[model samples]
Target chain A: MSKRSDPRLIERVLRGEHAAASRALSLVIDEAPEADALSKAFFPKSGSAQKIGVCGPPGAGKSSLTSRLVAHYRKQKLKIGILAVDPSSPISGGAFLGDRLRIQEHAMDPGVFIRSLANRGMIGGVSYTIFGAMHVLEAWGCDKIIVETVGTGQDEVEIGKVADTIVYVTTPSMGDEIQAMKAGVMEIGDIFVVNKSDLHGSDKALSDLRSAMSLGRTHEAKPWEPPVLGTSALTGKGVDELGKALDDHWTHLKKSEEGRRRLREQHKEELSLYISRRVYRSALDKISDRNLDDLVEHKIDPASLGTKILKK
Target chain B: MESKPFRVLIAKPGLDGHDRGAKVIVRALRDAGFEVIYTGIRQTPEMIAQTALQEDVDAVGLSLLSGAHMTLFPQITKLLKDRGLKDVLVFGGGIIPDEDVAKLKKKGIDQVFGPGTPLTTIVDYLNSRLPSVKKK
Candidate 1:
């Protein structure tokens, strides 16, 4: 650590200093003592970035879709941030975090930043650590941030609450579209993309999504129907359309009061969740060993005991 | 005597999702007696920093296979400097080219471990760079 606290680093990062940004992210992820104070200092300048979450079942090519979307976004001269969450190994409580190698093509781009989060047995599917990461990206001036979930479970649905736009990706052959629909994936998507569209039954998959959308009574909103686009991410087909759809959504959002309201609501939800997690962690940390023994001996139900202790 | 274990945060930056190398490094770091926080693939500079801050770690090690190291590393370094965390050593390993490694080091990256670099190299580097603490 340097003897002097250098605010220049933050300024440099804001000025697009990639090195500075990398360093700052390291500090944040590592949770060094000073990192919190630094982030607090930079908090006022954060939240300018747009957050987008992409989620779907495992093996649905979520990572591939994210890589392609990032490439498309970069072409538009926008700075992008990516977060790929992977499940932790249950036995070891470790994670491979291997998604980074799949998109090595963008390894050198200054306009793109990506991070992989280990689930760490976080029951909600998304890792507890990811929320902090999202805030850091916003502070770094990324125009858009994409968060990819580990699995397409209910936990993945939580992402819809964090992102400004939620894109649900499904491949044609994996029967994921059906599973997604059954899992209520259709309800959360702002945009549905059928990647690997060159495969057999691509049209059928598209029709399935279309029929799924039609099965619902209303189109959700005027001029805001969730559009399904076929994409062969391998060949870069339909990527442009996907990008345009994202732009269109952003434009629509800007034009509508509901969009702003939704954003505000999302922000409130995020803040509440953040605070709740902190409070829960703090309260749990305060639990005494004697209390644990009592609970283990069935002297008290954990929930009621916790409520009683919290009341104090 | 009980001693604090060195805590290290291993993060992946950029859209590259191939984390085989990062995962290997995380295990190596843990086996070497450090408490490792492995942030899985596709991390941005901002996310990495935030996790690092919250975890209160001693070192931040990034694993970037994507060529975005140039853009990602500098931002992380700057953020640390900006937030007054000059002591937390920031290093990484991946498909980074030798020339870029030099550039990153010059930009305050403590070290850059490229492909084919041994896990022992990383373990040794951490052991050397971090302050000595008693292992539990």
Candidate 2:
């Protein structure tokens, strides 16, 4: 385990070796502090990689769309990084993050780097692996990165906190929260997409998304209003347009001051999460099943126990 | 820390586009609590072998229905052998004949599961055969 800190492997990764990067990411996913500390060396190289988050409901074709984006970016000779998250193993509570890409297409491509992780093994539901992975991708010299979250529900907007540009993918047959809601996950998107446009209600879905954006809770005359686009992941329709829209959003972020502001927020959030995890684990270590048992039995109180652990 | 979860790479080799079987196995293993790494479809022997090595998975399950299993199965096995990844168990499924299955098992292919075999059999096979990972 002490040998996991060997810097030679990470050095290999930074020197444009994809296999070494793969090994580093595996160690990073396990939350090895040394591996993460190695990643911090690459922090200065970060903030340059374009962060794009593709999130949507289950079965919304997020994977296929991401595949299209990979192809699009590949055409421009861009080195790409993709962090794909799947589900947790039902029994062991281990993450079952699966690789969604057909390996033959891009596995051989030197310009593309792909890794999979899941939301399991979270410390108080805080994801440090992802943040570390962002750095790893940047250090690996990827020009752009696409993070596709495990398809969460309409109200889950965690992806927005990490990604610079969030693309909300939806199909025409999705629920009403995306179209007409007070404050659902739909509001977090910087670009709205109605995938599977070949199906019925695609027009309605697009129109409804546009209407929602008009009355969007965050649509308060901002410099960058999100564009609603229709796409068919099956036929690769409108994918080029989607790519263009994402580029436009990137342009807006850079042209205006909001992009830097968002990056600042992202940086702060990331640092805050690291701090919170450190504190959480330290505090958690001082706790035991006995403390919970005592609390449950009314032998001890919650407030005092917290203070006692903190004092230690 | 306990043990890392058992991770499997479910790969499809050759031009078989039918993923209904692959997906079924994916869900079953996921439900049974194993991380399934799927790199995509129409993969080559090199891709599967390299993916297994990179992911450091405990096992590799190849699904091929293109009648190329006789070639693809042993090809993946030989690749794994060449990479010195002999510890990584190799199993496969899809339209293979009984004779080919025997031939594959002889070629260092661990097991060949054909159609109509219960998903539970594959699940059980994996559970019993593969070693669990060390977790924290």
**How accurate locally, in lDDT, is each candidate?**
0.73, 0.79
What is each candidate's DockQ, to 2 decimals? 0.10, 0.37
Question: Clashes in candidate 1: how many?
Answer: 74
Residue A148 Cα positional deviation in candidate 2, in Å, after optimal superposition: 0.6
For A100-219, candidate 2 gives per-residue lDDT tens digits of 563236766778877777667542212567888888888889889988887777576777778889998989998553444547667788898999999988988888778866774463
In candidate 1, which residue ranges exceed 4 Å CA deviation?
A1-9, A30-47, A176-180, A219-221, A297-304, B1-136
Give the candidate number with the greatest lDDT. Answer: 2
Stretches of candidate 2 exceeding 4 Å from the true structure: A2-6, A89-104, A121-127, A175-178, A216-221, B15-24, B39-41, B53-56, B63-70, B80-87, B92-136
What is the per-residue lDDT of model 1 for residues A231-274, given as tens digits with 9 covering 90 to 100?
98788899899889988888877788857776777667657865
How many collisions per candidate? 74, 8
- Per-residue lDDT, model 1, residue B66, is 68
